[model samples]
Target: MFTRFRLASTLAEFLGTAALVLIALVLSEITPVSYFVATSLAITLAAIVFIFGPISGAHFNPAITFGMWTARRIGTLRATAYVAAQMLGGLGAWQLYQYLNDKAVPAQSVTFNTTIWLAEAVGAFVLALGITAAISRAVDSLQWAVTAGATYFVGIMIASTASAGYLNPAVAVGLRSWNAAYVLGPLVGALVAVNLYHLLFSPSAVPVKRKR
Candidate 1:
């Protein structure tokens, strides 16, 4: 059963991340408006979570995997495996996008700055906060999906000005923006977010009243 669960979870992460990256690449290319892209990505994320959350907790991001690991919610081996699978999935999606478009993958670059880093950090914080909140509440899969979608929409919209708003490290890999700002910012933000959630917002943190 343990082996079976591991296989299922790994496969789910690969496929879910692939789907997300592929859609994001296509949308980024065709959509002219950033708001529209953000909206589309949000809906796509909701759908992915609705479908895959039961199998693997729908973690398609390395930052999320890291956060879960830090919170001791997932084993270290599984977290490492998830991160590897997610990165491969991003690469797979990029290759697929190139083939579908019948074009070579173009060189992409972005300037890294404090603003971008801070934006990514803020965006990741919002995302991780929503995820942790949903988990703490033990919300149903549908509610979780909605929460994920809403948080991602808000995060992307807020961060798009200073950064591409690839709040997930896996998505950053897929987008070829694998810079320090894009990568470390989200990881740090998620780290803080998860810890903060557990420290202040988790049920355990709520003080219980003594009998009168």
Candidate 2:
């Protein structure tokens, strides 16, 4: 499987991530729907996972790609490709959202403070860990859904104060196109969160029995 990285799978990863970013931008721009944006994101995540889980592991996020890479679920080269795909996919999504909504500039904001940055870091850590756990089968579908829903809910709640609780660095980069100046605080926070998550919940640290 490591030697074979099919174009279909690669594009699927791109499409899945693209769809998610598109929905997120639309929700953030068309409506200040707040937590509803989180719900939409969660729904998109579930859809992506269900559709592309078997193919490319449906990572769609760089943090997740890092977590899985560290966990030995994927190789370094594939991880790099996956991250590239996710970033490009997110950018593509934003562009498409702009085209559809007829809005040249996406609704962009960066309200960063120490506490807010910490909140973003912690939120991102939890979100990545939750995604890892779900994909790892550490939790059942019901629990996975709950965890994902709650993560987005909490992320959205703290968003206005924390650069919209963006948990993915790739996402931050994607948002940067709309505004040339992107906030560094949340970006650093997100990277720190993923690394911390690896330290806390990496597979080597948290062993499990093989499924029969």
Candidate 3:
């Protein structure tokens, strides 16, 4: 039973991440405006969360998985499995995109500087904040989905000023921008966000004042 559950969760992560990356790659090619692309991706992600949240908690991003693991909400082995599945899913989506287009994915030359890193960090921070809030509040899946989508929409808009605003390590890999700024920035942001949420916002973190 445990093994079966693990397999189910892993497969859910794989499929969810693949769907996200595939849509993102297609949107990048078709959508001319950044607003439209961000909107579409946010909607797509909300749908994914609604569909896959019951199965795998709908992480679909390594940054979220890392945050959960850091908060001790997820086990180490499971987190590793989810991250591996997400990366493979992104790669699989890229392959599918190439096959569908019958052309090579375009290479983008993005310089990674402190500004870009900070932008990515900020994006991930917003995303992580919403996620942790949902978990802490134990909101229903539908509400969580909306919160996730809204956060992604705002995060992408904020990050796109200095970067492509992948905001997701898996999506970055799919888009062929697997650099430190795209990877480490989000992870660091998630780490800080998770810790901050637990330390300052989580219910258990609140201090109870004694009656005077």
Candidate 4:
């Protein structure tokens, strides 16, 4: 049940997600800089959140969308649509990266362990927590941009050793071809984060006066 106007929101998500993948893919191909490329991701995500927040809430990641869904910020069907659009963005980025990098970044099969999985979950939780705060108390695009940027900077620094730091499911599917850790860990973390936000910080409902 997408109205024509809502389609723009989907497109915004697509562009933002694809931009992240493209930037990450390109940065990863650079020598030496690839080792500490979280800055690139942080800057790009910050810019996207600032530019596209009004259009789509600047989700750009399925985990964030799922977090919002769990927190009842978005309806289920709309969240599904957003997720679909995000996957497409990832697919587009992967194809573009393959073409540009000559398939240099093939998806590797990971030997998953508890520690890596926990890293993904914890990173995603913190990332989602930042997103929740940005949405809940955002004064302007600048605040959201800062929050998203900081989350990526810290989260990637931690998660990179553990899971290649695919905190965004869009990146997991698009860049890493859907490894189990990339797929499940972030979603679980998003669920936990959203629930925690709901319990601890989300604004409570107020009773309304009935018709007089």
RMSD of each: 1.8, 4.5, 2.0, 4.4
| Per-residue lDDT of model 4, residues 84-104, tens digit only | 989899889988889877875
Off by over 4 Å in 4: 31-35, 203-212
- The global Cα lDDT (0 to 1) of model 2 is 0.64
lDDT of 3 by residue, 137-156 (tens): 88899998999899989989
lDDT of 3: 0.90
Q: Can you list the residue pairs that collide in candidate 4?
A: none
Q: State the weakest 10-residue window (summed lDDT) of model 2.
A: 177-186
Candidate 3 has a TM-score of: 0.94
Better of 1 and 4 by TM-score: 1
Off by over 4 Å in 2: 1-5, 106-113, 138-150, 158-161, 177-212
Error of 4 at 6 (Å): 1.0
lDDT of every model, 2 decimals: 0.87, 0.64, 0.90, 0.82
Clashing residue pairs, candidate 2? none
Candidate with top lDDT is 3
TM-score of 2: 0.74
lDDT of 1 by residue, 1-212 (tens): 35988999998899989998998888878876779988988998899889988889888889988988999988989998999999999999988998889986665676678898999999999988888888777889999999999998988898888888888877877877647798888898898998899989898898888999
Relative to the unseen true structure, what is the C-alpha lDDT of residue 11 in candidate 3, on a scale of 0 to 100? Answer: 95
Indicate the residue-level lDDT of 26 in model 1.
89
